[model samples]
Target: MENKTIILTGGGTAGHVSLNQAIIPELEKLGFRVEYIGSKEGIENELIRESHPEITYHAISSGKLRRYFSMKNFTDPFRVGAGLTQALNIIRKVKPAAIFSKGGFVSVPVAMAGRLAGVPVIIHESDVTPGLANKLAIPFADHIFTVFKETMGHVPKEKSTCTGSVIRSELLDGSAASGKELCHFDNNHKVLMVMGGSQGSALINEAVRENLDRLTKQFNIIHLCGKGNIDERLEGHEQYCQFEYVTHELPHLLHLTDLVVSRAGSNSIFEFLALKKPMLLIPLSKQKSRGDQILNANLFKSQGFAHVLEEEQLDAHSFLAAIEQLAAEEEQLIHAMTEAEPPKTAYEMAKLVAAHAK
Candidate 1:
């Protein structure tokens, strides 16, 4: 019998690609020939290329789907059309059993292409609100998986399943001692991790830097400051360590984290939840995004899984106070996290996707 094959599509941000990463191994283990389709210049291309060389990678043309006005808006529809054509060609050639999409602009064309190719498409939405790209792809999707129960109301009830998020297995096996050794910090002080998502957050970086003196006195800080966002002047600080970003060591760093200050990206927050790390979320302001982060942070806060300090309200002083509050409420947050059901594992999600395949 021919080996089963599946195509995974998603990218724009790490969040969009992360669930695919989590499930790829499971899919491989289940005897599927995994393939990926993403933008030529996207982070997904790099990430998938470097991490899973076994899977074939196809680069396709994709245009950003912006809500606000731009000259690109007129031209981007043509790019999207070109992307759809490219995706259709690839899908027809591969003749895969199913297409799994993590819901980004890149996945929109791919999802449509899957529909046109008569391939089943399964889309996973990570946020409380569906992103514009996911909204556009919904009608073409045969099944929809969501991280939040609230998201079901927005989708066709017959097609939507609240599967929660998929947490990578590697993240759960981190050694805190290894993290402490890597960071050159002793176990005497609490370790605080500040992450600003894949692209980094200027607001979070500045606020954390401004409060470093006060923060360092209380905790050892591991700052994943994003690519090219590191402040060289603070490189030699005794109690603070900063990296452009971490891949292999992220698990260790997360394991060592006593508390977290981060953006409310759905993937990162869900990972923190899986690890039971108490967090202070500073979501991007409405001006910067579609307000999905704000909603994510609010959901976490309401669920007692995290504390939120909106970007508009964030300053050095307030940021520090929120950290203190997170520290004080650590036990409550951990309790909530412990009682919370973990998301469907990658294996389970893979099975669900496979069951929907042609």
Candidate 2:
């Protein structure tokens, strides 16, 4: 059999690239050569380059999909046009059998280019509602895979299927003992992990710091503080360990965690659910996002998988109280999560993409 090639395009944020990360190995195992197209300096480029160096990475112009007015918005359409041309050239050159898009601004052009090149395109939507870029790319996509069942109603039902989230397999094999050793946590205390998405959250960082002294008394804390968000003032606290960000060690850190405090990014929250970790979610407010995080938090809360604390309501007292509440209700959350269906779609998705390959 001839070696087939596929192109994966997603970027701008970690959420857009995570599904690709989860599916790449499966695709490789099935004998597909994978290539990635993203912006020159987007988080996707950094993540793919660092984690999967074997993937051929292509950089294209990136345009921001803004909902609000900005001067850059005027110039960005041209950027998108340029990106489409670049993607078209790359698609023509590589002659990929199929294109898999994870849905970001960078994906719009690639999806369009793939359609024009007569390559089958598969898009995965991670949010309850389609994001702007995905919304635009839908017409060009041959198949749309959704994480939420409700999302199918919003799209052309004929083209969309509910696949659940693609969770990284390594996350399931984490060693609790290794995690405990890494954080220096004793069995006497429960371990709490705070994550603020990939870039870190200033709001969450401040809240955690203000409540650290009180929190440390009950739980050992492992905080993934995001790049450049670490506090030098809290450097020597034995009960609290801080990392600017974690990649290879994330699974171990998660394994040791007794509870999680995090943003309601779809990928991260779904991972927490997969791990059956009881969580307190502080979603980004409408001002910061398109309200997807709020919807994600609400869905998890309604399903009894998590507790939601709006960022507007977060303070040191409220934060501590929420943690306490999550602790009290941890058993219920874990039970609900355990009863829920696991996301077993990585292999299924890989097969679906390969089936479409020319």
How well does candidate 2 score on lDDT at residue 247?
Answer: 83
Query: Tens digits of per-residue lDDT for model 1 on 1-358?
Result: 7539999999988888888988999998898999999999999998898888889999999999997999998999898999999999999999999999998899999999999999999999889989999999999999999999999988899999998877888999999999988888865899999999888988889989999988888899999999999999988787899998788799999999999999999999999999999999989889989999999999999999999998889888898889998999999999999988877688999999999998
Q: Spell out the clash pairs found in candidate 2.
A: none
Q: After superposition, how far is residue 126 of candidate 1 from its true place, in Å?
A: 1.1
The C-alpha RMSD in Å for every predicted model, in order, reads: 1.0, 1.2
Model 1 misplaced stretches (Cα beyond 4 Å): none
Best candidate (score: lDDT)? 1
Clashes of each: 0, 0
Model 2 local distance difference test score:
0.91
Question: Candidate 2's error at 168, in angstroms?
Answer: 0.7
**Candidate 2 TM-score, true structure as reference:** 0.98
What are the models' TM-scores?
Answer: 0.98, 0.98
The residue ranges of model 2 lying beyond 4 angstroms of the native Cα positions read: 1-3
Candidate 2 lDDT, 1-358, residue by residue in tens: 6539999999998989877987898999899999999999899999999999988999999899999999999999999999999999999999999999999899999999999999999998989999999999999999998999989888999988888876888899899888878877655688999999999998898889999888988999999989998899888678998999888899999988989999998999989999999999999999999999999999999999999999999888899899999999989999999988887656777887898788
Q: Residue 80 deviation, candidate 2, in Å?
A: 0.7
